[model samples]
Target: MKAMIKVTLKNGVLDPQGKAIMGSLQSLGFNGYDNVRQGKYFELDIEAFSKEEAKARATDMCEQLLANTVIENYEIEIV
Candidate 1:
């Protein structure tokens, strides 16, 4: 199975990197982008007998290391 994980800063969290990217885009004449929140996307392959098992493992992976749950939120999709 393949899993796609997306981790992103929670709302109200300060994202300096996102701000910098937005600034760079503006400098290059790319306007109308007021806010940009950067996130991480991870693809993984795992051996699981069932979708439920895969989801559980993927959730554990996010809680353990893939995302900082205190300041970030994550979503996992298994395929």
Candidate 2:
């Protein structure tokens, strides 16, 4: 089974890196973009009997280490 995890900042959180990217984009003439949010992606190959199991395991991984629960949100996909 393959597990895909996406970690991103929660709403109302400050993102300096995203701000810097947006600034650079405008300077490079990539206009009309209002915001740029950054995130983390992880792909894992694991042994699981079903999609549910794979998603559960990936969720555990995110909560334990991959994501900062207090300030971040995570989504799990099994493929």
lDDT of 2 by residue, 1-79 (tens): 8888899999999999999989999899898668699999999898999898888888889989999999999998888
- Minimum summed lDDT over a 10-residue window in model 1 is located at 26-35
lDDT of 2: 0.91
Could you tally the backbone clashes for each prediction?
A: 0, 0
Question: Residue 62 in model 2: shift from native, Å?
Answer: 0.9
Best by lDDT: 1
Question: Model 2: residues >4 Å from true position, as ranges?
Answer: none
lDDT string, candidate 1, 1-79, tens digits: 9999999999999999999999899889997668899999999998999988999999999999999999999999999
* Model 1 residue 10 CA deviation in Å: 0.5
Instruction: Identify the candidate with maximal TM-score.
Output: 2
Model 2 steric clash pairs: none
The TM-scores, one per candidate, come to 0.94, 0.95
